[model samples]
Target: MIDIVTVDTPHPYPPRISAFTRPFWEALAEGRLLTTRSVATRALTFPPKPISPADWTTEVEWVELSGSGVLYSHTTIHAAPTAFVGDLPYRVAIIDLDEGIRLATRHIGEIAPVIGAPVDLVAVRHTDAVSFAARSRA
Candidate 1:
């Protein structure tokens, strides 16, 4: 298990964009979630890659997900990094998307989430980038 720690000072860090990850970031900016799908096995990969994991196939495609998921696991952070300090006592959770992929995301809502509870995607905008949050579904 990895220990989550609070940083000494919050730094304004942005995600580094590479050739393979550009599309994913662009999609996020457009309020969409993008992933890479293997052409051969139809396997989907987050943190998009250039080659397929199954057969090393270079022919992969960009796919969009519905962004609906369930709360799989979580932790409440009393101490956070600079960027997130204002949102202390926030919940970081592992969400199991309906499409079968799991992602570590933040719960940005008022209520605490329950394990196995329904969640939905909420777009989160930073200074120069956009990410996502998992919130309880209404």
Candidate 2:
């Protein structure tokens, strides 16, 4: 199990959660990643949409992800926008979740990111809410 570290410095921007996205947020708070899947098309939608974003169908079900994936791409930003300047040298990446849904999230851990490297999801606790990051698997 990954430890969800609570940062003294809260995130400047937190997502606005709604009923449609509540399951996802609740699971993340428990260190589990949950999303919605389209029952008809097997398409996955992150952020737990009420309807299938791919087919606009109302037949959606909650699914838990394995939380293992590969880093498709990543880059470190030395210069961030004004709202994020305090957190300098932060890294972000596009991850190919094993379930076939791709998500963009922050990167954590000391390991240098490499393309195709295996990763696992980690929950980071902030003052306002919980967030996720991809940690490199050595």
Candidate 3:
């Protein structure tokens, strides 16, 4: 497990979001979020895309999620990659949002999280980039 720390600096690299991903980013910027839903399989797909990987269908729709969920899994890392080195000992977690979509994000807040712990998504601004944090249970 990596000992995770909150990153005070902005992301060093530019996030690459394509045309299909524009809506998702836009929603985040607007405080309204969107994720892709596969019509055929009735599944929520994160890392939004125009087509579904399972059925190859271009029927993906942008759906808003509650942004509240539980921490499905996580790890605290002491050392990070070059770009993320400044934020050593940071917690990386997979949050299972209320809508049933699992999103990987940096864990934040006061307490260490455990599996099945309730968490809420919060948008945080770093020097130049915006990121999501999983808040510990209230």
TM-score of 1: 0.82
Any runs in candidate 3 off by more than 4 Å, and if so which? 1-8
Residues 1-138, candidate 1: write the lDDT tens digits: 111223344334567888879888777767788889898799987657899887899999999888888999999999888867776777889999888888898786767789999988766666556666787865
Each prediction's whole-model lDDT (CA): 0.77, 0.86, 0.74
Residue 44 miss distance in model 2 (angstroms): 1.1
**Highest TM-score scorer:** 2
Judge candidate 3 against the unseen true structure and give its global Cα lDDT, from 0 to 1. Answer: 0.74
Q: Which ranking of candidates, highest lDDT first?
A: 2, 1, 3
Per-candidate alpha-carbon RMSD to the true structure: 6.7, 1.6, 5.0
For 1-138, candidate 3 gives per-residue lDDT tens digits of 111234577776646777777777666655555678788786777777788887889987777777788999999999777887777778989998888777898888788898998888876655665555687786
Error of 3 at 78 (Å): 0.8
What does candidate 2 score on TM? 0.91
Worst 10 residues of 1 by lDDT: 1-10
